[model samples]
Target: MAQQKVKRLPDADVEAIFGAFAAAEPEPKGELDYVNPFTLLVAVVLSAQATDAGVNKATKLLFQLADTPKKMVALGPAEIEDKIKTIGLFRNKAKNVFALSQQLIERFDSKVPESREALETLPGVGRKTANVVLNIAFKQPTIAVDTHLFRVANRTGLAPGDNPLKVEQGLLKIVPDQYLLHAHHWLILHGRYICKARKPDCWRCIISEWCRFEPKTPAPKGS
Candidate 1:
């Protein structure tokens, strides 16, 4: 099927949309919880194909057991798997978690690298994970186009693209500087809770006025 032509929102509309987002959530935050950059990195890796709540549930004990790279390596892949067994692809994720921990110690001296390039070198840490770490942990103005953010970006015509990388680039180019830092978290939240994949909740959306999605989703039967 041919893709619908996405209407590009004007810069003025985009500014107002972000203004609404900022007013609604002055301090947006990622759902994943972590003690530090290393733990945040691990949480992001575990979040692939899984929900934030799921990752947090598994990481509660895992982080306690090994928040640091050295400690994580000491915990071993087997134990890592055991701890994160609740998450999908636990075995592979465990291996990645352990291997990445080892890399952090060997290559970066046990500290999570601040640069996205260095972060991507770690096992299971891809562009999305690196962007998440860069934005959340290091406070870099990087946008991580996760499933949620991708939907919001494209659906709203704030920055439409076929793939995540394209969407990421589009957002980075147009997002206002003042709102850039929190833009990622805001878009993710908007998509996850408002512009859902199945049916976007346009009725209660904060930026519905500026969104480009047509035939906005109507309110359900019950108020």
Candidate 2:
């Protein structure tokens, strides 16, 4: 069978969808736990291929021990590995975490850089990760296209694209200026809770009226 074409939402529909999201959640925040910008960077790095809940769980003690670059460097890779062993790719992530800490201490003067280029220079920090750090840490209007955001953007016809970068660019171009800052959180929360991959709870979706997805899934039988 041929793949169905995803229709792009019009300007008015996009505005309405975001407006509904804003009304429902005026200040959407990322689920990641962090003490400061440095901890936020560490959390986002450890969150690669890992769930927010899992990352938060692992980082609870870890952050307490090493919330700063100097502290993380002092903890060393072995300790970091042991702390994050429950997460996937713990070994490599630990190495990246340690290296990034050292880099921040030596190069950035123990500070998390706000620029995307500088952030990406750190180990394990990519475009998506950098975007998250920029948006959450620095309050930049950046859309980090993670799995949830990617699915929601495409499925809802908000910013359809084959890859995350394309979807990110598409969203950056279209999402209204007023809603851009919180748009990332809104889409991510909606995707995680309502517009899920296996089965979206379309009946409860706030912007279902503007969604271009066909045959919306109904709420399970009798509530």
Best by lDDT: 2
* lDDT by residue for model 1 (1-223), tens: 1224587799999999999999999999999989999999999999999999999999999999999999999999999999999999999999999999989889999999999888888899999999999999989999998888888888889988999999999998899999999999999998888888888889999899998788888988988
Write model 2 residue lDDT over 68-128, tens digit each, in one string. Answer: 9999999999999999999999999999999999999999999999899999999999999
The TM-scores of all predictions, comma-separated, are 0.97, 0.97
Q: Which ranges in model 2 have alpha carbons more than 4 Å from their true place? A: 1-4
Q: In angstroms, what RMSD does candidate 1 have relative to the true structure?
A: 1.4
Lowest summed lDDT across 10 adjacent residues in model 2 is found at 1-10
Q: How does candidate 1 score on lDDT?
A: 0.91
Task: For model 1, state the Cα shift of residue 116 in Å.
Answer: 0.8
Residue-pair clashes per candidate:
0, 0
